[model samples]
Target chain A: MRIFTAVVAIAAGILILGGYFFPAFEGMQALLLNWAVILAGAAALVGIFNLVSVHTDKIRRQEKGSVYSALLLISLVATFLFAMILRPNHATMKIVLSGIIIPVEASLMGLLTISLLYAAVRLLRRRADLTSIIFLVTAALLILGSATLPFGNMPVLGTFVGPWITQVLALGGARGILIGVALGTLTTGLRVLFGADRPYGGN
Target chain B: MIELTIILVSAALLFGITLWKRKSPANLREIPALTRLHRTLGLSIEDGTRLHISLGTGSLLDARGGSALAGLAMLRHIAERTSVSDKPSVASAGDPTLGLLTQDTLQAGYQAAGVEELYVPTSGRVTGLSPFGYAAGAMNISQNENVSANIIIGHFGPEAALLTEASDRDNVTMIGASDELSGQSVLFASTQDSLIGEELFATGAYLGAGASHVASLTVQDILRWLVILALLGGAAVKLVGMI
Candidate 1:
């Protein structure tokens, strides 16, 4: 089964990738991608069902915070029903998104700042390596210089050092990292294409 | 055309390297993050505590899927190593497609370890749909599941801070890797150990997933140098033309 799956996966990958360089294979590629999209949508449904079952089990088991699980299930059912019946473009559905979902994610985003600060402090306390120290110092300088100071602006740190570090140093490092990431992604994709890595086949 | 040529070249190099190094173990540079992860995996098995792997919200339908694949590679190794433990490893993924694959990967790992009976499908979960929601869900698992270590590897954003913070509060050893630059920055500050940029893809190689992985690393190095040379050569050519 694994070998069968591997052969199918490799052929699909090759055809899809091949379409990019040769237009002759595009029809096959499009067909494969369409199948992928349908499969992905079904996979998402299965994932949601898995989520529902997990919470349901938690409630049945009377585990800790089962009340939360119950609440989640209720919300999930309500949203799913509303989105399905109302076609998702209805104002009621939008409110559920804007009123409930957006605000909740917004609150978490607001909380993220504090979380980042706490983590940074923890990082310094835990590691205290040269790289950590440099990272901390650079961040401190960038944050301090990022905003308009009460004095309108800092003379040195804000204007020169901050801009230099971010634009020159950080950008260069980021580009290097991006190039490395691209290389890695390429190899990984190639491996899958050549059937050397059978992540899908579980070999 | 160029992209195709590069891919073909890389494939050739990988096969060549694999055959050349088939008789001997390839020597690899030490990455402290992976070294620490190796130790943590061992400790979790010995201590009978589970390791939690967060595959993040990387959809397999897009470019972001690369990181999720890396996460799966790491999960495969962790699950196999911890398969015999009283508390087997749990994997949480944010995407449905990824969640399904993760379950299969977990099962395969258990099968490899000769303990497929102990594999639980729920152990590979789709925590949430949205980013923050996923982070919160994953955070809860590490906090409440007696997890000895947290492996956060995939595409992530600032929401990763929440997971790292939760791990920190619980004193669980956490190592993070992300394909996103923002995610990398967040991980650098938040986690004790992080695999920056392409280092995320090297997890499988470090974990001994297969010889192909090691061969791919060598290919990566060779290709990296070629890219550098091309860039420099292009600039030099342009400079001469300008003069």
Candidate 2:
């Protein structure tokens, strides 16, 4: 069964990838992608069902944190029902989006700021390596450079060092990583195509 | 035409190296993070602690799915190695298709371990669709589940910091990797062992998934050198033209 799956997958991948160079295979590529999208959509529905079922079972068994499970299900069903009846554009729906969802996400972002700061402060203590020192120093310089004091902007660190570090050093490192990641992505896809590594459960 | 040529060359190189290196052991360089993972894998089986694997929200329908697939590959390797533990490993994914695939991968891993009946569908979860929602859901698992180590590899944004805090607070070992540069930066600072850049994609190879995984790394190195030469060649040619 795994072999059959791998064969089909390899063929599909080859055809789809070949479509870019050979115009004749474009239709098949598009068709396969469409099929994939549809399958993904169906899989999403199944995923939702699985999530609900998992939580539902949790509640049924009176597991630890059963209240949270029940709350999740209730909110999930209620929000879904409300959106269905009142329409997504309705005031209540808008409240759910703007009031609950947006604020919650924003709060998390706020938490991220604090957590990032905390991580940076504790970084030296944790690793204390040369890389850690460089990372912390660069981060500190960047933060300091981005801010303007109550009196006036600094001359060196603010204007010169900041732009040089960001535009040259940071940009160069980021581009290097991007290129490596591109190569990695390419090989990964190729590995799948040649049936070397199958994340699709064939191996 | 150039892209297609590159693809064909990569495919050829991958196939060639894989076949050539089939009998001989792959000489992969030591990555500290991966070494820790290897030790941790053994410890998990010995001490009966579950590993929480969070595959970030990368939809399979798009280009971002590459990291997600890599995560799945590592998940398969981890699941198989740890299936016999008193507590089996659990996986979480943010995207639905990826989540479903993780479930299949987990089951397949257990099957390979000859413990098909021990497979639990709920062990693989679709945590949430949104980024933070997914992080939040998986965060609960890291804290609540009998997880000693958290392996987060895939696509993540700043929300990854949230998981970092969870791991840190719980004193759980976390080895995080992501295709996102920002995610990498966060994980690098927070987690002691973080795979950076292409290293995230190297998880399967590092974990000994198969020869192809190692072959892909070799091909990546060849391509990287080729790309460097191309850039330098282009620059030299342009300089000569100006001269």
Docking class of 2: medium
Looking at model 1, residue B186 earns an lDDT score of 96
Q: Which stretches of candidate 2 lie over 4 Å from their true place?
A: B241-243
In candidate 2, what are the lDDT values of residues A1-203, reduced to their tens digit?
Answer: 88988999999999998888899999999999999999998998888988898889888999777798899999999998999999999998999999998898899899999999999999988898999999999998888888879966667988899999999999989999999988988988887777776767547
Judged by lDDT, which candidate is best? 2
Instruction: List the global CA lDDT of all models.
Output: 0.88, 0.90
User: How well does candidate 1 score on lDDT at residue B19?
Assistant: 79
How much is A161 displaced in model 2, in angstroms? Answer: 1.1
Candidate 1 residues lying further than 4 Å off, grouped into runs, are B241-243
Q: Point out the worst 10-residue segment of candidate 1 chain B by lDDT.
A: B17-26
Model 1 clash pairs? none
B1-243 per-residue lDDT for model 1 (tens digits): 788888888888988987776777979999989999999988888899999999999998899887887788778888888899989988999999999999998988998999889988889899998899999888878877799999999989999999988888888999999999999999999887799899999999999888888888899999999989998999999989963
Clashes of 2: 0
Q: Per-candidate TM vs. native?
A: 0.96, 0.97
